[model samples]
Target: MPQGPGYATDLADRYDDWFAPPAATTDATVALLARLAGSAPDGPLLELGIGTGRVALPLAARGHDVHGIDASTTMVERLRAKPGGEKLTVSIGDFAEVDHEGEFAVAYVAGGTFFELRTQQAQLRCFAQAARRLLPGGLFVLDAHLPEALAAHAGAGAQTVETANGDPVLRVRRLRPAGQRYTSDYLVFADGLFRHVRVDFRYASPGELDLMAAAAGLRLRERFGGWSGTPFSDTSGYHVSVYELPA
Candidate 1:
């Protein structure tokens, strides 16, 4: 079972594999942030728990100023190793604890990082700190998995996929008790060899997320089923909700 606090430590070495994206969905949330950022500071966007530069550097490449903070030095170090990462700025600190003076046009937590905070108090503090990083009328975006998809896979199951190299892939799933964590086991067949890897993520419901945003004095502006503007529904697999810092 994966709890909130030890999540980063457990995921540190294997972070890249879990988030390893082939194409289409990579930084899918970025498009929404760019769109919602309209009429805001445009000064610089702040990313909470920005991992591996999935969205930060790309946003910077698009000519928007970006800054990010993460608790894992290992994650930040890996981000710094990436091409665009070397040039981008990242702070090695907790999003809930780190204090920055600059007001941002947009502050976001992508790839489900928002739920890593675990407890309601910590989650609320994260929102409070993140909101303070934003200027008035600034936008705060958060992406998380939908409860239905998780409930759909309540039991363990497996799927086979191929990697970019045409290697066979086997993915197994198991939902932890209370729906607080998900464990995925992946077996890869490459070079006529097979190796198994595992991944874990802490889960949060949409209602829990809404309450956290409200706790920080931020209003839920809109909720989307996916990064591509799908309307939020119980059946949707994931969510992308935008919040306001009480302009």
Candidate 2:
């Protein structure tokens, strides 16, 4: 109903094989989240756009109660098939508007998934929903690419071909500054045919996202260049921002 996941179905099954980050990156991300979330006794955690439980699974393994919302059943199925995935609760729908019961101590949208909303209004709604699902003093963490990087490439498209799993994959992307959005297409050759996936996204700067969080009655806590707690700077390529609901 919500256009069936921001990710292309063809890519869902092999998402990890094609795009999984290095183990060190995943471990760092999980570590930061665990530090921010504190102990398992605080409360359950929620992940928006869980996407095969890349971040969620590890957190769950650490003894944190984790729940998730995802639009792709195929992707969730992949998560469910993995160890410990079947025990977690997951809701299937547009994460911005879907309702999940109860509040959480920590809620996060990682891996630049916030951009998938494709509209400022929708992104704002997502902030509101995240706020609604958080308890007082709860934290909402967002990881996204810095908009300036995309702005530098605005008004033109780029293409590149790389080999993944012994297959040639062509990637193309176009950025439109007018709407602050971008579209990317990935074509992977398999058995002499092309497996295509397209993604459309709207991006906002850290300042813009701060304004959205304020509108949702959340306040900025901290922002870092990455999961390792590097200080945010003008040249930082991405950010991991933490917003908190008032106690």
In order, the Cα lDDT scores of the candidates are 0.72, 0.83
**Best candidate, TM-score-wise?**
2
TM-score of each: 0.81, 0.91
Where does model 1 exceed 4 Å of error? Answer: 1-18, 98-101, 161-169, 177-179, 188-199
lDDT tens readout by residue for model 2, 1-247: 4745435355677777555565677889999999999832288999988988989999999998999998888888989999999999999888887478878999999877899998899899999989998888999999988777665544345544433355666667677778888877777667778777778889898999999999999999999999887899978988999999988
Q: Which candidate should be chosen as best, given lDDT against the real structure?
A: 2
Clashing pairs in 2: none
**Tens-digit lDDT track for model 1 on 4-62?**
23434554444555435554555566666777776565568888887778778777787
lDDT of 1: 0.72
- Residue 82 in candidate 2 has what lDDT? 93
Worst 10 residues of 2 by lDDT: 155-164
